[model samples]
Target chain A: MEENSKLSQFQPVKSIFEINREERMAPGHRACAGCGPMIAVRQILQSLDVKPVVISATGCVEVTTSTYPDSAWLVPWAHVAFENSAAVASGVEAAMHALKVRGELKEERPVIALAGDGGTFDIGLQALSGALERGHRMLYVCYDNEAYMNTGIQRSSATPFGAWTTTSPVGKEWPGKAEIKKDIMGIVVAHGTPYAATASISHWKDLMTKVRKAVSQNGPTFLHVYAPCNRGWRFEPKDTVEVAKRAVETRFFPLYEVENGRYRITVPVAKPRPLEDFLSLQGRFSHLLKPENLEVLKELKSIVEERWSKINAAASVQVQT
Target chain B: MAQFEPVQTRKSLLTGDEAVAHAVRQSSVDLVAAYPITPQTIIVERIADFAASGAFTGQFVPVESEHSAMSACIGGALAGARAFTATASQGLALMHEMLYAASGLRLPISMAIANRALNSPLNIHNDHTDVMGSIDSGWIQLFVENAEEAYDRVIQSFRIAEAVNLPVAINLDGFTLTHSTEPVEMLSDEVVRGFVGRPPKRDSLMDEAPKSFGLMSLPDSYQFFKDDQSRATTGSSVTISQVEGEYAKLSGREHGPLKIFRPGSKVMMVMLGSYAGTARTTARRMKNDGEQVGVISLGWLRPFPEKQFLDALEGVETLMIMDRSVSYGAPAGPLASDVMSLLYRYGIKRKVIAVTYGLGGRGFLEEDAMRLFRYAGKSGSSFESFFFYGGE
Candidate 1:
């Protein structure tokens, strides 16, 4: 597990402007400047080869993009509620099939569901599981910001250990969050999805590639994209991308994909940076760096290392086969 | 042109649930997304059988839960498909949030609710508690008296919803209408097709003209959207009457939103759902016994059939209203509250005896209806109003 094993490598792209695709998400919407999830949203729309109908669960992206009387979406978009985007997309896919069978529609468009970590890992887990298990021809993208940022930094299952969220405050008895981040990708993979991947906004090329591959399949695909929130993490807006990049470098959030039950580490880390390098940049983790909380910091590092080793093992087995 | 000619019909004995499924089968629906729940389970089961046998060619999605069921219906409708779903009691309660979502989006999806009681000790019995709780969810509510009305309303509900650009719920009593078999005169597929016609074209998610749906509204425009929805719902009475008029011409069955049996009586008994049949029979027997009594059954509750309901109560000075559900901390029952409000609006002073009965699938016989009517008609007992029947 100590040896860095690379299965698939992504070429470093010089700029996002080189990819010649129409920007389906219009500019001048309500998203905050330096918002990490909006970057993922823009790239996902640009990566799509077909005209896709988008289903959005209630969150930052949905509220910001879809204010009444005006919408930032240049394509068909819908925001149903907070927890039912997957099920809504399933219905849209089924309707597309039905319409095609009846010859009412000339061609079938792809269906995509977009939600946050709160929607995906917690409230929407059942719906996501149902959509994946039913094998709907759609792609579900979870833009994880680690907590419920829209509701003002409430702790979610996706909130990491030692993170200071409103619901998981740093108190005398409790350092920060008492629980580790939920393994949502594992839960999704256990559904036997044809394609599932973990991505980060820092790696735009890798994230876009996975999006294209996901929609090309004739079954459900899942993409869990790590989005760094400057507001929630109490970091400067300019440091959003830097913070995300450090997360990947520390192996805190790995970039990987699984296709047909085979795992492939997309961006393998040769030598991971120290966990403190990532934690020092954000105020949410500043309390954990104190001398009195050094033990909690040590535990977090071990947890991160253990998760990285598991991914390395899973990818290495595929290489050996 | 089809309305000018004689229509061919077939007679079959069907429970209310089967009748709704048959309507769906013949309605040329594009999708039926539902989850199985008691009483209403047969509706989806029958739709599944129809899908299996090729009688219904629509997409039938057995969703994981009622919340997902309603969500899928909203999605399907947004994608320009005529979607339908069914649930009962707890299932409807589970779908309460999405009910507002469906109507707020103005998706025009039709649903059949096998009216059942909400559970505390978990009873699967007939009551109006589920839909009563969702009364403010903004969907057009239609109450059916029997299997035939359930079948007819299911078809009419589609046209009504589509015409008004809103969702409609056909409320049929759980077990009483859903399980009890009754003879229904089903219109032929051709006649039914002609009656409903093809769905009108609208701006949909799949159309060439791209538009966003279910957008968030802040304080600036939220009230406008709700005002528009409210106007559309209340204004649906005109469209409803027009569609029912057209349907009556074709099927020779003319049951409007409000029906009066033995109108112009001094004392009237008003209620909704299948119990109206009992009230009708009981009212007749009491009239023969030299009592001035009548029965009024309302089919549409949301739009409230205000004008016709008032006109039917021309000479009535007293009303004995029966409610199958209770409204805790309110002045009266759900239906009675609406009636009282309508009376207050019109400045019509009538003594109202608000009574609750037949809860949790309990049987309501002719004796119960006659006893309530007699109790309300008694001269000196008028002071003691607003009580429950068959209860301590």
Candidate 2:
């Protein structure tokens, strides 16, 4: 949900052929079970329509796809290192612009990247900040699953409160490791990006729709989409998207967009479900079923409700203006 | 009638910076991602003026920081354009992270790191630490001793970098060579046109066709990626000589790895950059005394002229390394350490003396250079004038 884009009411494309289908992320990649990110990535490539230069940081998507001579990618790619994806992308854009101006360029292309939670939240944040400040025409997709799932299930800054990963496992004295997830979406919006959105595999159409919005516009755009990891969550493989849908329905992971300085929830909460509906499916939250812990969990759900209300109220005020 | 040589010559007097810019300008370099740092600033400033005035047809991107400067240059190079930039001292250090990225990908990116000392409290002076720190990044490093060479080497860099299909750096001492403008006789436009032609590759990425650059490499394939880069860089020495030779043929002035200013002398001072002139003057003085002193100026620093250096120092008992910057906590200067490290491999364990001198942009006078020759120790000494500055 990109509030600014919602407010503008996106205009229709000029041509059907240019329906945004640059297959920078070619099909047939080997990701894990319940990996919502690969779906999100596939939809993004479908929307671009033009070939895009991709600079990927280290993490699951990169490791799984780039396995030597047999890459899941059909595009010509160079993988530098984790902390430098943003830096490397900046170089590609600069090089492309130079070549085009001198008539040395044979084609015109869009440059973007797919960065994971570890890459975006930890190692590559500084480079990302620099890229935004420089105003490169790039779209960065942060596929965040709230934890470091690739490396034996560890806690990350994006991991939610009261979640149980290897580092945040449940214990007799405490109800799993505790701490709230950082407001990464807010940070991107604060950077004053032209387009910023939070989407989830829960709303596939909305997630793919925002990807189109981001690439068409100039300057830097960031999309932080929620991904569910079944291995880490101890859930059945098939319930991945359904779990995500439940999280959104319960308003735990709200689907929304933030653009320029406005905010808008892309998929309105027509029927906000109970938080327990979203929690019961995953084993990570099984411990919360205990009486006292359940009460504490209810308090957390109420906090999410209260936060979404304020955001909705803000959007309504903007609509009034 | 004598046979007439129809020569295509571009002969004009220019500052070292202008000469270098003219070479690149002729190369039709499409992008320049450089910051305004001392010594090197002149090269970029002149380029900025040229780009702004439409004297050259290219994009002059004013990056926010040195990190972005190098970052942007890498992008442009990867996109398949002849990309270039310039920096000095702290600016070079700031770009340290991007250096590995550029070389690791084997992008034909070119940068001029005006040799300057890195800072703690802050000192803006000439030193090799900035470039020396980047020695292992796998860039082809070329050192120029004066304004004329600065112009010449930058021109040759594009050829060497593109030839090796790797990034290249042309290092010149700050202020000494950069700020101090001398009459640089640029080759004719025809000569430059004949020298640096267009790039072979087109824009590597386009909207119609996407490509992945700087992608993630796993442990399984990391060694091969680096090995490929090594092969590309090591293969550059041959192209470097070829390009330098062509440029020399066109301009009638020769320069390359271990280019001998005066060959076959009993005692020779080996060095690079502005101080080389001072050494030559002292060699002239020492030669008059029948001591057989001479000077050997090495233009290429990274793919060092080991064979030639060994040959130059063969008969000489004392090989002096005139280091302008110290390596700090090391036994000798960075260049000396490199020389010593290779001495056993090259089998030239001659008495190579180390001398650290002329830091923070201090002047390295002829008198100071003469003192090293007076010692007859064959080992180089630091320029001692920095200690006795501001005297009555």
Best by DockQ: 1
- Model 2, B1-392: lDDT tens digits are 22212223444455566667766676678788777887677777777777766766766767667876787777677667778988888898888877888888777888887888888747777767677778888888888877788778887888878777788888877766666657777776566767788776543655334455555567888999988887777677888889888889877877768656557665566676777887798778777767666777778777776776777765666666766666768877877777777786766556666666666666767776677666644435322212222101
How many Å off is the CA of A166 in candidate 2?
5.5
TM-score of every model versus the real structure: 0.95, 0.86
Clash number for every model? 0, 41
Off by over 4 Å in 1: A1-18, B1-9, B380-384
Tell me the TM-score of chain B in each candidate: 0.96, 0.89
Instruction: Give lDDT per model, in order.
Output: 0.88, 0.73
How many backbone overlaps does candidate 2 show?
A: 41
Model 2 lDDT, residue B140, Cα: 88
Q: Is the docking of candidate 2 incorrect, acceptable, medium or high quality?
A: acceptable
Error of 2 at A124 (Å): 2.8
Q: For model 2, how does the per-residue alpha-carbon lDDT over A1-321 read when each residue is reduced to its tens digit?
A: 111232233433344464555554655677886677776666666655444667667778777887665576655555666665676677676666666666656544666767878778877787788777777777888988777877878888887778888998888765675777777887787889888888887676787778777876667889998888888877898998998899889888888887777888888987889888888998988877778687658666777888688778867888889
Deviation (Å) of A83 in candidate 1 = 1.0
What does candidate 2 score on TM?
0.86
